[model samples]
Target: MQAASFTGILKAIFYMIAFYYIFRFLAKLFLPLLVKKVVEKAGQKFQQQQQHSQENPWNKTTAKDEVIYNTANTKNPRETKKVGEYVDYEEID
Candidate 1:
């Protein structure tokens, strides 16, 4: 009785592993093609939009951008040089 039950359990486990490998193989074969189709469709839509539009918001220039300097002041600020005041090191014994 125990032997039959053990055999059935082993068979079930083997079938589960086989099914897992089959699913993984199918995914590997078709997943990339599915992704490629989605990307191509999106790219086609974007190209159509660009061809129909004259001025793109992405390329528009704003008033703030025309300023000579992005900073508050127009003249460049001078950076102060930093000098080390002191240094110490230990000698090998």
Candidate 2:
């Protein structure tokens, strides 16, 4: 079995530090551009939703609609008519 030497350990540490700095530089260079693109996409989506709502009125119903019911205003009482005949049932065991 080959044991790792001090030089190999130092090289690994250096490579890790180099990779960390490289990733940090890349994030600094591209993070703002990515964020800007995301914000622009969100704005465009919101505008499209607004325009769609404006175009179609069916999507604009709020929670405050008032329901009105009109009843009959007759002076006399409503005459009730008989509807059905009652049936007698017998059970056998």
Best by TM-score: 2
Cα lDDT of model 2 by residue, 5-86, tens digit: 9999999999999999999999999999999999999999999999988898794678888887555645666788989889
- What residue pairs clash in candidate 2, if any at all? none
Give the poorly placed runs of model 1, Cα more than 4 Å off.
1-4, 55-93
- True-vs-predicted CA distance for residue 15, candidate 2, Å: 0.5
Model-by-model lDDT, in order? 0.85, 0.92
Where does model 2 exceed 4 Å of error? 59-93
- In model 2, how large is the Cα lDDT of residue 38? 100
Q: What's each prediction's TM-score?
A: 0.48, 0.63
